[model samples]
Target: MATAATSRGFTMPFNLRLRRADVATLNDKNGVLEMRRKKRRLLTSDWGVVKCCCSDSVVPIRMATGSGNNVEKCEDWRFDMKKSQNSQVVRAPAMRFASPQPRFISKQDKFFPRCSPRNSGPQSRDSPPKRDTGIANEKDWGISLLNENVNESGTNEDGSTWYRESGEDLGENGYRCRWTRMGGQSNDGTSEWKETWWEKSDWTGYKELGVEKSGRNAEGDSWWETWREVLHQDEWSNLARIERSAQKQAKSGTENAGWYENWWEKYDAKGWTEKGAHKYGRLNEQSWWEKWGEHYDGRGSVLKWTDKWAETELGTKWGDKWEEKFFAGIGSRQGETWHVSPRGERWSRTWGEEHFGNSKVHKYGKSTTGESWDIVVDEETYYEADPHYGWADVVGDSTQLLSIQPRERPHGIYPSLDFGSTPPTDEPPDESSTSQ
Candidate 1:
């Protein structure tokens, strides 16, 4: 009977398409219409237990109303199956539904084949196959089928897997795999896979674990394999003090006083040369002057000098006085003459005689001779023009003497006897001699 039934089951070719909105509306109704409509053909067909595959059509069903109205309503709708040529369509029972094939059983039975060697063993469908252990231990599962001559086992005591024949194992650090010409199955029995082995450092970012331990010793000091050591307690204390002082100084000012001090300290510590000091000094000076110098004048005075008398007195004491003499000017210090102009020109003898009765000529003679010169005023008793003279007599020839008198005639008279021109020569003494 099972054989006859299997022979009666035939594959049908059908396509199905349903609007999601229609399905949602059908679920809102009583839904009996959808069930009856989906099974209508199967219930009436000649086949005893007909099975149907859903195709392209809607099925509506009627549901009895919960209300006491004694009325039935459309409750829901579902997809329907269509009969294809040489095949019969049937729906499941009202409470039954179709389901997809079971997955766990199929996977457990190795229903799907795998292509990897690691998955090709007898227990491949159960757990992953244990890697080949012929090269070494189970942990040293290497590519032994490719290079039979190589000992593909990890070097460390942990016995980890390895695929390369040469070079040190990465050990606790996992081995680095890369393409090489040495291990794997190929056309040749002695085929080589693309893999290589190198020390951890041969690649990147691999460091070795140290055998000797590190850290402090019994006296709470670092192990003394070398002289290098950390800062001492006193050194740290000094640094703390310096840092606190700096912070205090910084907080005390609106400007960064501590920054400047620290910078200077650092600069000093670095042993700057004279040139560096000079350069920084100039920079600071210029900065200060620019910020503060605009209020003053070129001479740096913002206030005018007061107290006229005091200023005059100060001027007299510290400044030179300009004095205009008759024909010369002089700048004199306390008791000594600082500067003198050229000597005044002498008066012509004619003008001197006319203005001062010839006594002026005698005075000039006295001044030049530096000795007492007797001049006859009325004869008999002669008078000395000057008592002091000496050394003044050293004057050179009087031919170069300048005349101080004005021109005679229209220009001027009385004060001058025409000194600009030759004066009238005194009448020569009478040539006739008086008889004794």
Candidate 2:
């Protein structure tokens, strides 16, 4: 590659070619012409030659390096015949070449005003220093407080750093506790995130009442959920159970592909039964959540309700919260429903209430572009309450609400369960190795 250095010390590689036919000749001689007159022509004095043999006429000279790197033809570099003949010696502007060493060109060299005697004279000692308009200092932008409370830190064998912190305080019940472990690794652009939970427990033996655990993979494409009864007191029976599961699809041809379910049921020695369930999932561009809880006082009072909400890629949102309570002759039911449009230009709401034997309904709506309405209807009625309405009425023989059956693998939630003391590895384990 042939390289040419600019006056500014920058080198650029390019090919140059000049044919013999392109060379200029005077009196049948190339480059040098036999002196036939007193007049002379000068190309440049800086390159050493002041006078050239010949009549005072412009002679185009084609230059070719011995290495074959020749100059291209340019009209601007040639002298005019009239101008050369009228003057004793005509000289072209001196050409400058760059040094072999390379130099960096900064913005100040091209964009900023330069200091010279013509524009800017020498500064006086009494004058203030000029301000630099370059990058601003970090203090001017405000300091980050992320590492303010980092008490203990250390480097891992993998070259990543880890931090550990813990605190405790006395409270009305006993003492509150907190612990945290976090760090990151740059090997694969992977970060490790883990949180420590402080459960509400007595200072003596902070028994594991119940477990609430949740986690998501690095890609965020997969999620895991778990909830179980860890403290099985004598009041609870072996039948008491809880578990969770998750499902995920590969990235190819899949949209919003993830599902999670959680369920738990517990019974006390006093005969009070507690059961609840939660389920949610995504399909295509839409996602939804469903949850309902049930409680039996062991007498005749029972409460059951369902809460659900859903949103779509179109920005539309809707939800419902409804519940019903029944005893002997005293029964009450209430429900609320709402929906929102994609552009928030329109919305609708409907709600109703029932107590003993009276009921009322109210609804409000906002239409698109200058249209809206509000309505409320009150209905007075009396009817005999269902005295036999109870738990048996909702579930006949099975303890599990067949409709609320949750299915998934549990990633273990008990405090006693050993989730490795070491932080999660920076890289996710290979599937093949994990399966084995």
Best prediction by TM-score? 2
Per-residue lDDT of 173-233 in model 1, one digit per residue for the tens?
2322221122222222221113232111111121111111112211121110100001101
What is the alpha-carbon RMSD of candidate 2 to the true structure?
Answer: 40.1
What pairs collide in candidate 2? 245-408
Model 2 Cα lDDT, one tens digit per residue, 388-420? 212221122111211111122135522232235
Output the TM-score of candidate 1.
0.10
Single out the weakest 10-residue window by summed lDDT for candidate 1: 240-249
RMSD (CA, Å), each prediction: 63.5, 40.1
Poorest stretch of ten by lDDT in candidate 2: 5-14
TM-score to native of every candidate shown: 0.10, 0.30
State the local distance difference test value for candidate 2. 0.31
